[model samples]
Target: MSVPSKPWDSELVAKWLEGRIEAAARDQATADRRGYGAEDDYDKAAAEEWVCRSLRTTARESEQAAFALRIKQLLDQEDYRITGIHDDRRVERHVRATLRKIAKMTKANEGFENKLRYQ
Candidate 1:
């Protein structure tokens, strides 16, 4: 039940989010140049689609970070409760199982999941 490592790095994710937001803004400018029924209107539609996708990506990353922080908080509380326990591996396994159960019980996006890896 151990949480697997996430392929996406938080710092890298943050950078990409920032880049996407900037791109979305820039695209908005391109999209604004055309009026209704004008030629090159497709650019505006495409730009809007990109903006929506970028916003969704941002939301996903934020949610993943919040979930990770929640897991860390749960782990910290568990550690505090199990002071002086000598069985480190067993303790970790139990903690992992508990965290997994809690995570699964929580609501999340239907088709998306993020792993919580210990640093």
Candidate 2:
């Protein structure tokens, strides 16, 4: 079974859930002619599920980046690596990854979600 999260993060989780719901609505609408009545509530349920999944995924990724930055900084400070390592391709990949990380999975808190921003 999944473990519980802290109460302090409830708002953030709620926002995530809203986004998921919106996305699910769009998806379901596209998938079938008939839907489970109560379109609004169905969207809300999708959002809640999304929020739970998102918090776990994003937080874990952020932690990894934080760890990598710390490691790189420490290594640089040590003046080690006489030979070439972490080449341009490797560095570029991480840079792109870091940029993507900053984009966020949703803008649900702004009262929009599931759909791309400005949708």
Candidate 3:
């Protein structure tokens, strides 16, 4: 079951990226103040890369979280029979797996989506 995403909001992404970039700047400043020398530049680069990766992961997780909440709202409004699933644990597992799959697909499709012109 593919969950189609709403169109990407450039403003929302820009806001989120702004925060991440500011945090990275702060991190670099802290490292410099701690006497990071030439040899540590590599480590600094690696740390910055990690921060960027973390930001991307966080954005993906947040999207998944929003999707899951919407699903829950629908289930509640429609009065789905959770008991019919036999085990609540199984249903919970399935929900988690579905969210993970959605996150993965979002990341995988990001590059292709970037190439398209919306307007």
Candidate 4:
């Protein structure tokens, strides 16, 4: 779409670009609107990270952060970032569940080590 031309000296061009992007959002249903499956893997990871940082009111805030960090790290290793997903609550739940699984695995390993030491 053609942006209205301002005087050559006016930096209104940047503002025009921003407006176009906003209009695109208004015209379409973003991923979060349709749920987690709609978003790409990278976006999902980033959303999970944001959820950990932003969803402070959820239970076990520290665990959420850990999960977020883990997910973001994994995604980053694969070159990913959050986008297109607008729901923070769902992100928090996913991150929490992932963290719980990781925690269980770690605990199991530690228990095994302790038992080996006793033997």
Candidate 5:
């Protein structure tokens, strides 16, 4: 997977996640209003599931965004040298490998986000 050319808008994501949580809470309250019955039980369970999924997604995205920002800052330094490592080439390779891993994870997260949208 390739890293997205566009930067992640952390603020935008935060706002979106907030909206999702609020919506989920509203749905859960509606479900609760239906009273304790089979259909109500199902509705409550579904609402809980949606909330859990959203929270999980929010956590992952927040962590990834923070990691990406830190990596970008690290790369911006003029003389970023790892302790006890003199070979710049080795450091470069390690950074590149780490970046690739992050890209792969981000791609997977996008897929999950899409799945949630459709669900």
Candidate 6:
């Protein structure tokens, strides 16, 4: 999938992450319930916890994406100026670095989702 050209909202990203996490947890809980051949609260809770633990990497990526987006937005703002950066080159460098970070996060997330899909 192609990354959106428009800027991403941090809140939206957070909500998306929460939804993904919840869905994964629910799927894990259901699978655990099926394997046990019965619905057990404790087992479901344990399965959810395990799923959350396994999704730490995904959560981290979401956080990085949000951070990168925020940095990009700040840099793009006309009024926001870096005190130390007197030259346009330095400012451009910062913007480029943030963009790279966003791109890296996007690629990593896509690869991770693809791995999950094949699994």
RMSD list, candidates in order: 19.3, 15.7, 16.7, 21.6, 16.3, 16.8
Per TM-score, the best of the predicted structures is: 5
Residue 101, model 2: lDDT of 36
Give the CA lDDT, 0 to 100, for residue 66 in model 2: 45
TM-scores for all candidates: the values are 0.32, 0.25, 0.32, 0.29, 0.39, 0.33
Global Cα lDDT for candidate 2: 0.37
Clashing pairs in 6: none
Candidate 6 residues lying further than 4 Å off, grouped into runs, are 1-4, 36-119
lDDT, candidate 5, 40-76, per-residue tens = 4334334333333433444446655554454455445
Candidate 1 Cα deviation (angstroms), residue 48: 7.3
Q: What tens digits encode model 2's per-residue C-alpha lDDT throughout 1-119?
A: 12323222334534544555466556545433445454433333333333334344443344434423433443344222212222333433433432233223221123222345212
Model 5 residue runs over 4 Å out of place are: 38-119
- Of 2 and 5, which scores higher on lDDT? 5
Q: Model 2, clash count?
A: 7
The candidate scoring highest on lDDT is: 5
Please give the CA lDDT of all the candidate structures.
0.42, 0.37, 0.41, 0.37, 0.45, 0.43
- Per-residue lDDT of 18-58 in model 6, one digit per residue for the tens? 45456645654565556654334323333323333333444
lDDT-wise, the better of 2 and 6 is 6
What TM-score does prediction 3 earn? 0.32
**Model 1 alpha-carbon drift over 4 Å, by segment:** 1-8, 37-119
Off by over 4 Å in 4: 1-37, 40-44, 47-84, 110-119
Which consecutive 10 residues in model 6 have the weakest lDDT in total?
A: 110-119
lDDT of 3 at 70: 45
For candidate 1, the per-residue lDDT at 104 reads 49
**Alpha carbon deviation, residue 55, candidate 5 (Å):** 5.5
Residues 1-119, model 4: lDDT tens digits: 12323212112322322333343343234544655566543344544344334322222333433533544454344322345444555544555554454344333322211211111
Error of 6 at 25 (Å): 1.4
Candidate 3 lDDT score relative to the true structure? 0.41
lDDT (C-alpha) at residue 8 in model 5: 56
